[model samples]
Target: MISGLGLSTGVAEAEVESRRSGCLWAGTSHSQGAEVIAGGWAFACTADARGVPTWVPGGATSQAGTVPNPGAYTDPQGLFSPGARQPGTSYTDYCVGNQLVEGTNDVYQAVESGGLVFWKAAAPISDWNFDSNSPRPEPTWRSTSNCYRGSLL
Candidate 1:
């Protein structure tokens, strides 16, 4: 019975669990107030919406006041690179040290395709810290284009 922006009614438990299993943190979008999942030691993105997806440079925070990576970096040479070279279009290279949780450095990117926008995030390294009690999963990338419908929901 989970209800919120981008989530359809009757969402299955398995689906929710799957999303949770892979994400280090999942919550709402900072700018659009849409739900988002991040920090999974891999790249992940949400499905396309009816309208353009809002990119929050400051990243999103949880209800508990916890802020994730907050979109601090940009990849000019990699995928999800913004259009044209411009100020505020690039950021420091994202790495494990930039993550909210230790050993969970992941990058989140939003892109447009087929008249829809999608979010992408990934954590490229594993075992960032040998002493970390909980080792993050292997580096990976994922994207979901159907997770949102637009600013309307």
Candidate 2:
């Protein structure tokens, strides 16, 4: 049996009954079509199944360049690793990189505070001393409060 009770937004009350599977189901919902609600509350953003926030194309004012320091030769995998300096190298600073550490890059952990994690990436560092004003690519790392819920792999 199937029926539609006619609801707003092209939605309708639905009912289904099947004897082959020996089951009955009834539900009501709306299509994922674009619509606005009262008081201006709407789904302004789109995300993956895991709830990772994603931006729509041409929706941003200006997108940042390549993400910084994805990972390094050495570092355990976890959350976001920030401010990790390369051994025997001073030219790189991963914290300022455009890399999304928590999503894809390495997750650096804090020895003292377990809740803290660092996100790092290679980025172009601007030099004020040079009149050319060319940004030199270097490691840019940043630290943020990491409340790691879980991991995919």
Candidate 3:
């Protein structure tokens, strides 16, 4: 195991082949240290489903001690699903250009680019009620209340 903020040490490395999982399991023993005070760090390995080592973002000695992707990385399966998640639900709330939204279930990804949010789904939520767009007259408490109700919660 690699060492870092989580503080982990590799004690043993063994390969176990299994047809059920259809891969070689590299059993590793790790010793975790106490809560870190400073120098927070994390560690991960690059390996295929099999015990064989695969070239992942970061390898033991790949790219002069630099990982392939720093801020982002893709999974073995070609899928790019990103977004803010709500607790205890697969449902995600996507955003568009910093405009928060309630997303649907079709597309499973959300991305923020150029100060705007984009979704992979075909359709997105399209209902915005600004304070000025309230039905009530201006300077009226009813208008303000209507605006708040029209807007998201």
Q: Which one wins on lDDT?
A: 1
RMSD of each: 16.2, 18.6, 19.8
- Tens digit per residue, CA lDDT, model 3, 52-137: 32222111221121111111112212111123111111123333443444333222223334433333443222211112322211
Task: In candidate 3, list every pair of residues with a backbone clash.
Answer: 1-10, 5-41, 97-116, 97-117
Counting clashing residue pairs in each candidate, in order, gives 22, 30, 4
lDDT of 2 by residue, 1-153 (tens): 235854343222222111111110011111222221211112222333433322121221222322222223333223211222211112122322332233222222111134333224322221111112323323433333222232111
TM-score of each: 0.23, 0.15, 0.16
Please state the error at residue 14 of candidate 1 in Å.
Answer: 23
| Candidate 1: tens digits of C-alpha lDDT, residues 1-153 | 345666655557655454333222223222323343233222223222433333233333222223243342333222232111111112322233323231124333444455332344433333111222323334323222212432111
Clashes of 1: 22
TM-score rank, highest first? 1, 3, 2
Q: List the lowest-lDDT window of 10 residues for candidate 3.
A: 31-40
Global lDDT of each model?
0.30, 0.23, 0.24
Of models 1 and 2, which has the larger lDDT? 1
Question: Model 3: what TM-score?
Answer: 0.16
Candidate 2 residue runs with Cα over 4 Å from true position:
1-46, 54-117, 127-153
Candidate 2: what lDDT?
0.23
